[model samples]
Target: MTTTDSTTTSTGSPATAELRVDRLETVLTPTERPVPAGPWTASLVFAWRAILKIKHVPMQLFDVTMFPIMFTVLFTYLFGGAIAGSPREYIQDLLPGILVMTVAMITPYTGMGLNQDIQKGIFDRFRSMPIWGPAALVGALLGDALRYSLAAMITVALGIAIGFRPGGGAVGVLLAVGLLLVFSFSLSWIWTAVGLRMQTPESVMQVSMMILFPLTFASNVFVDPATMPGWVQAFVDVNPITHLTTAARSLAHGIPDTGAIAAVLVASVVLVAVFAPVTMRLYRSER
Candidate 1:
């Protein structure tokens, strides 16, 4: 360390004295630094980071890959005959419903992951950086969208292998998937908000699952709502998941259900509008 001598000086009134250092030095290094990244560039970098984590720990994908496949197969084989009289016949309706279910179930992981980041103090570290504030969260959401896409594709492929033939053909399948992705993307925001408000990752997981289970199970994903009790039918009638599943099925059959699709789209937009702001506010105020 450089040494300095301190001298004391008295003002003319002799009431106030100041201490002065002969030489002052600072710790800053003399180095040229590159310009900071733009918001989009910064977000993309964080997104790439999320992707790399998956590459290293491929098992993290089990929810999106294995679980979706498992659900599609198990439901088709075990309950197909009981529900629709034959596995092949049942799969036609079941595939579209199951795709919605799979994505709905998995979207909550976004919140749990956020809670984990906070627990590990990674969230604080990201917050202290000079980059755009929401980049980390935005990047994480984008990465999760990719996982949702993977689950959707795997579910569709497995359905096809087992006897699913969408009357709407490839175009209908693609349309359904596109609609599903938007819904999933919006749904993840709810979990993201919950994650920030919760004390632990487990709390986030538990709460998210609680909300999702009823939404997916109580909806018209399996049997027709008409088969359900009239009271239950009332709930199913307004369930967003029911709308999504019906729209998916309609699109898959080549006859689009404009009302259901519009409902799901409106729900998606509302979810993002409400939960996205809440998530961001929580993110900013998080300790």
Candidate 2:
């Protein structure tokens, strides 16, 4: 007599046992699952995630680092004498302009990343998690603070190399940077909302750049408002970015613009108040 050995499963039935055993094989197999993180925990994840993206896409640094240096070099060499009458004076004047513009340009990327996340369905996954309700988004926005600080410091270092110096001592310098980050941080929410609502990241980029470019350029960046056309002068004087840029220049070179500093502070506070809540609302809806 010939005998065959077979394994028994949940059921003694031969065919059923084979089916059950096969199912068991699948259940026992290893599989991958995404880890769940809460809002606060998600914030930490988002922050590190942003850092990792920055590392992988090092080219993104081109705008913050290279843009300032290139523009400074080009403008100083090409238009310094014509515009400011001398390279040295141009460097001094242009440094503030470049720093402000650099910050302005770098900020839109905050929206770009948010838009990408929304498009990729990452936000939906975030919603499913029991983490801090808005913490992940807030953390992502905060992540850009590091980028802004790096850009600001690098731009100032470049300015120093080209003979620009902040007359404001260490305290003033710290204040200036603190103010810049505050302004940038608050402004970040507006773009974050845009990203959440928008479909394409590119659209967010274009719209943000259009809004930001004019704001920075129309400010007292490279030239005095007196030279601007009357209407332009009115606009420039009133631009909130002008106040901050002027304040930053004051902190750097002792320009004595107390009113500008106050205006910047007020505007930054307002921007944060207006946009942060809006962003959270939008995030809640989508979640």
Candidate 3:
């Protein structure tokens, strides 16, 4: 008699065999779930990463550090005698303006860094990861706050070294610095928008300078608006930088001018409201 050994066949439906196949399928395929992180926590992580990057690339901070020193010293001495009768007197005015200018000048780097990441595929990778949508930009801005603060400190220190004293004392100086940082943080959103649209980091820098130079020089930063031509004074009257400088100067001198301060605050709000959404949209579409 011929007997066939029992074996499982396709036609043979055994419950144990089905269970084995199900186990095999489970083993063959794996599902990945993204780790959960709160938006603020994610942003802080990105900020920390950015700060660490500065350790490897110290030159990234060169502009914030050296520019403040050079501009503070140069403008204080070069135009001091003519502008304010002496360097000592001029710095009281010039230092506050320089603080604003330095922070404004460095704000573009936030965009440049963002553009570089986009070009390098880092931003693309970030998009793929599970995190808050605005975490990258928010974190970068947070990191830049440190840079702005550093520039402010350097400018004030250099000014003090050269006989520039704030009539407002420490409290007034701190208030001025705080106001500058708030404005600079908002101004960075504009560059962030520009950077998202630009093809290269260099282009972002170029475009930023184009927008910044007029705003910086045409205002009351270097000289009193009263000294400027009538035509220029008209523009200065509307220039947001002039308002910020005026506010900063008043705070530094222990003279509180609520109108100028309110103007700067309003301008900052408008800038962030206008540019922040544009930046986020561009960032989402980058891939």
Candidate 4:
């Protein structure tokens, strides 16, 4: 083992002291290193890393994949008769709402993942590296787009398999899916901020669920909100989830409600605008 040694001495002048150190030396081999990529490139690299993590931890996908299928199938069969006279009729109404709810439900995982990385010191390592500060978060969000897409596809496929046909055709369905993705991406910033603020991943999950459950269930997802009590109906009318579900339902059914689409888009933009800065600030504070 190499070690360093130091010594101190005082001269006759009492105030004068001299210190010397012996430095241990070791030979370092020269190695080629990749240049730092641009912010977008770095973000994409991190995004790829997020995707690759799934290969090692396949269960991470259970929520995105299985939840959609189960929610669609189970709800369609269980309440179809009571709600809409038949499963087929109920699916048309339910699938769109379910799609929105499913993606919304999954957004909290983004925060949970961030909290885990923070706790594991992975985020600290990233902060110390020569990379864009926001790249890690941005990349994770982008990677989550794939998860959202898969969930949406699985839900739609199962719906079709079990007798739900989207009247919106290819274009309408595509539009609805696109809108949902945008909403989910924007909403995730809230969770990311929560993750940064929370002390633990479990706390982040708990807080996110507390907010999401009412937002999803109280809206027009499973039943007609108008049928609820007057006060509850008032809340459902203004709920952002209700607007998103309405927009999705309209587009999926080929009804083309521009108002609902516009509302959802505006809400998404507002969410990103408000939460993104907060999340980034909290992220930097951690360093």
lDDT of 2 by residue, 1-287 (tens): 22343334323465553557667888988888667675677788788888887899988877778887887888787888888888778877777777777877777787788788777887788777767777777788777888888887887787778777668766666677777788888777788888777789898888888898899889887777877899998889889888888888787676558888889889988987898888888888843
Question: Which stretches of model 2 miss by more than 4 angstroms?
Answer: 1-41
lDDT of model 3 at residue 15?
A: 53
**Candidate 3 Cα outliers beyond 4 Å, as residue runs:** 1-34
> Alpha carbon lDDT of residue 14, candidate 3?
57
Cα error, residue 285 of model 1, in Å, equals: 0.8
Q: Give the per-residue lDDT digits (tens) of candidate 1, residues 7-126.
A: 332224234333333322333545687777878988888778878888999899986798888988999999999999999999999999999999899888878888999999988888
Model 4: per-residue Cα lDDT over 1-287, one tens digit each:
22232222222433433332232222334557788888999999988988998878989898788899889989999999999999999999999999999999998878998999999998888889989888998999998888898889988888889998888987888899999999999999999999989989999999999999999999999999868999999999888999999999999889989999999999999999999999989988844
User: Any residue pairs clashing in model 2, and if so which?
Assistant: 38-131, 38-132, 39-131, 39-132, 40-132, 166-252, 167-252
Give the higher-lDDT candidate: 1 or 4.
4
Worst 10 residues of 2 by lDDT: 1-10
**Poorest lDDT segment (10 consecutive residues) of candidate 1:** 1-10
TM-score each candidate: 0.87, 0.83, 0.87, 0.88
lDDT (Cα, tens digit) per residue for candidate 3, span 156-221: 888898998899998999999899888998999999999999999999999999999999999888
Which window of 10 residues has the lowest lDDT sum in candidate 4? Answer: 1-10
Between prediction 2 and prediction 3, the one with superior TM-score is: 3
Q: Distance from true position, residue 200, model 4, in Å?
A: 1.4
